[model samples]
Target: MENRINNITYDDMKVFFINKVKELKSWPYNGKNVVIAPLPEHVTVNPDKPSMFCFTEINDDYMEFRRSAFWLVSGTVVMAFMISMMSIAYLAIAVCFFYDGSFESTLFLCFFGSFFGLYVLPMAARIAFFIPHDLPVRLNRKTQKVYIASLILHGNIFRLRPELIFQEMDWKYIEGWVLHRSVGKGTPYYGLHLVENKSGDINRLQQACLYRTGAPWSTSEMEYQINNIMSTWSYCQHFMNYLPVPDETEKDKNFVFLSNNWLFKWPEAMDKASRSSG
Candidate 1:
C-alpha cells in the first residue's frame, strides 16, 4: 500500500542497473529486427550520479526527468552572479581608490584584478538573457498527469517572461517526437521530446527531453541514434500502456517515462498524483 525508498544500497542499485543495461542490450523489439523494438534506458547508469539520461527515479508509477548539463546551468548562474559582483566591484574599486583610499578596498581591487588576470567576461550584464533555473518535467502514470516546469512560452529573450510551474496535462493526449538541435558541433545530438498542442500563441507545451545517445551504438551512429529515440518512446509507450502489478512493487517497475531530470525537485509536485490509480 505504501512504497518508500529506504536502505537502498549501492550494490543493490548497481545490480539493478546492470540488469537494466542487459535488458537494453537484448531489448525485445517487436518489429522485423532488434533495432526497432523500443527498449527502456536504464536508470542511474553512473556510480556517482545519474548522468547520461538525467533520470533519478524510474518507478512503475512515475518517472522524473532532468536537464542535460545540470552543472552548466548551475555553474553559469553562479559564474554570472560572481561576474555581476565583480563588475560592480569594478565601479566600487574605482570609487574607493579615488574617494576613500581604504586599505580593504585597495586590497579588494588587487585580489580580484589579479585573480581574473584583469578581465572578467560580461556574463552578468546579459544574465537577463539566460534561463534562471534548470527545467524539469515529470510523467505520472497513475494520475496520468504530466507536470512540467519551465515550459517555454516564448523563445525570444527580448520579451522573456515567467517560467510557468504546475502545468499539468492528461497523459493520453501527450505526443513524443525524436528531435535534433545543432550547435555547430559538426554532428547534432538527437533526443526524445514529449509534447502536447496548446491553443494559444504558443503551439506546444510540455516539450521535454528524456533520452540521449547511449552505448551499444549501431554500425552507423545515426541509425542507432534514431533507434535510441524510437526505443525510448517505445519504452514510455510500454510503461504507460501496460500497467504492471509489480512482482516486487517498487522493484518490478518498467518503462522509463517520457520526461526529464531525475531531480530533488519533481517529487513534491508529482508525489500525490503518482500515488493514485486514476
Candidate 2:
C-alpha cells in the first residue's frame, strides 16, 4: 500500500509539471498559429522505406529521442561569427584612427563593423550562456507524459529565445506531424500549432518546433521525411497506447544515432522527471 501511494504521489507531481509548462510564455510560437490535422491512424508503411530511427534511450520507464544536432552546431557557428564580426569591426576602427587614417574612412569602418555585429547581438544573446547541443524528449509510458527540451530557431538564424525550455505534458494534449514544403511549397505558412492551458477554453496542445520548413524543393539526394515520419509516429504511438511496439532491433542497429554517450546526459531536472516513475 505504501509503495502504491508513493506511485500515486509521483504521478500527481508529473501532472503538476505538465500543467506548469503551459505557463511558459517565452516559447516562440510564431508562424505556427494555424492548426493542421493529426496524421491518419491507418497510414500504410513501406517495408523498404527508411525509418526515422531517432531513439536515444529506451527502457521500461520511458523512451527518449533527441532532435538532430545539426542546427545546434549551426547556432554555435553563428554565435562565433557574430563575435568575430564585432571584434574585427572595432579593431579595424581603432587601427585606422591610431594610424591617422582619413576620418571618413575610420567612420565608415566603425559603422560597418558595429552595425553588422549589433544586428547579430539579439540572435547571439538568445543562445547566450549555454549552447543547446540537442533537444531530448522523454516519453513516459506509464504516466503518459512527455518531457521535452525545445530549442527556438528559424531558417539560418538561431534564436535560442526560450533558451531550451524543458516542458512536461500529458500525451493526450500533445499533437505532432512531420511536414514537408518548399518556397514553391511554403515555409512558415505550412506548419501548424495550437496551445491553450485550461478549461478547453484555451489551446492545451504542447507547442514545440513551430517553424519546420519541411522537405525543400532543392532536389535533396536523401529520402523525403514524410516517408519516414509515419513509421516513427507509429512506433511512438504503440509505446503510448500499450500496443505491441513494432520490433526494429535489426533496423535500429543499422541506422540510428545513439545518444547514450556520457557527454549527452539529459539535464538533471528532466532526467529526474523522465525517470520519476521508472
Candidate 3:
C-alpha cells in the first residue's frame, strides 16, 4: 500500500501540518503524558533556536538533498573532473599493461577503484542528513506546558533507531518572540524566533514557527498578526504583564536579544529609500 504522507506537495504540507498539530494536541504519550514525537526539524521549527534545539534526523526532502549535492559537486567540480580524467587515463594505461601481461595492471585498477568510493561517501552522507519535515512540538492547554521531544538517530545501518530525548518547561518561561528580517530578490523576508528565560539566562529559542495561522508578514495592526511571529511576540509581551526587562549581560557580543533591531533591518530598494527620504 502507498504511504499517506509521502511525496507531499505545498497544499499537502499545509494539510499535513494542520493535522499534525491537532494530533500533537490530542495524542497522549504512553498514556502518562502528552508529548510530541520526533519530527524532522527543517520541515518545521524556527531556526535561531538553540542550534541543537531539535535532534537532527534524515528527512525526505530529496530535492533539498539534491540541491545540497549539487552545491557540493559544484564546489568540487574541478577536482571531480580532474579525478575522472585521471581515472580514464589510468584505466587506459591499465588496459595496455594487462594486454602486455604486466602485474601493474592490478595496481592501476585499485587506484581507479578509489574514485568510486570517494564519490559514494558524499552521496551517502547527504542521504543520511536528509530528514522528514515535521515539527515535534506538543502543547497541553490544560497544563499550559510545552514539550519538545527530539529523536537522535543512532546505531548502525542494520539496526538504526531513534533515541528519544526531550525537554519540558512552563509557558510562563517564554519571554517573547522576535522578528528576524532579511531581503531577497527585492522582497523582504521575515523569520519569527522565540526567546525564553527558563534557563535563568534570557536567550532566544528557535524560530517561532507560526505556520498554523499563516507564514509571518509585516502588518501595522498588531491584532491581525495573531498566530504569527510578530503577533506572538506581542502576545508574549502581554503574557509577561509588561515589557520584558533586558538582561544586562545581553549587551555582550555573545548574547542574542530577541529584539535586535539591527538583525531585523533590511536594505530598501533605491526608489523606496529615495521616496521615503523625500
Best by TM-score: 2
- Tens digits of per-residue lDDT for model 1 on 205-256? 3344455443223448656555656544554554555532222223322232
Error of 1 at 59 (Å): 3.4
Q: How many Å off is the CA of 31 in candidate 2?
A: 4.0
**Of models 1 and 3, which has the larger lDDT?**
1
Taking all chains together, the TM-score of candidate 1 against the true structure is 0.46
Candidate 1 has an lDDT of: 0.43
TM-score of every candidate relative to the true structure = 0.46, 0.56, 0.31
Give per-residue CA lDDT, model 3, range 9-100, as digits (tens): 33433333334323332111112211222232121333222121112221111000001111111222233345445555655675665545
Better of 2 and 3 by TM-score: 2
**Which order, best to worst by TM-score?**
2, 1, 3
Candidate 3 shows a clash count of 11
C-alpha lDDT of residue 209 in model 1:
42
- Model 1, poorest ten-residue lDDT window? 27-36
lDDT for position 168 in model 2: 74
Q: Between which residue pairs do clashes occur in model 2?
A: 180-215, 182-185, 195-203, 196-202, 196-203, 196-204
* Candidate with best lDDT: 2
Each candidate structure's count of clashing pairs: 6, 6, 11
Candidate RMSDs in Å, in order, are 15.8, 10.0, 20.1
RMSD of 1: 15.8
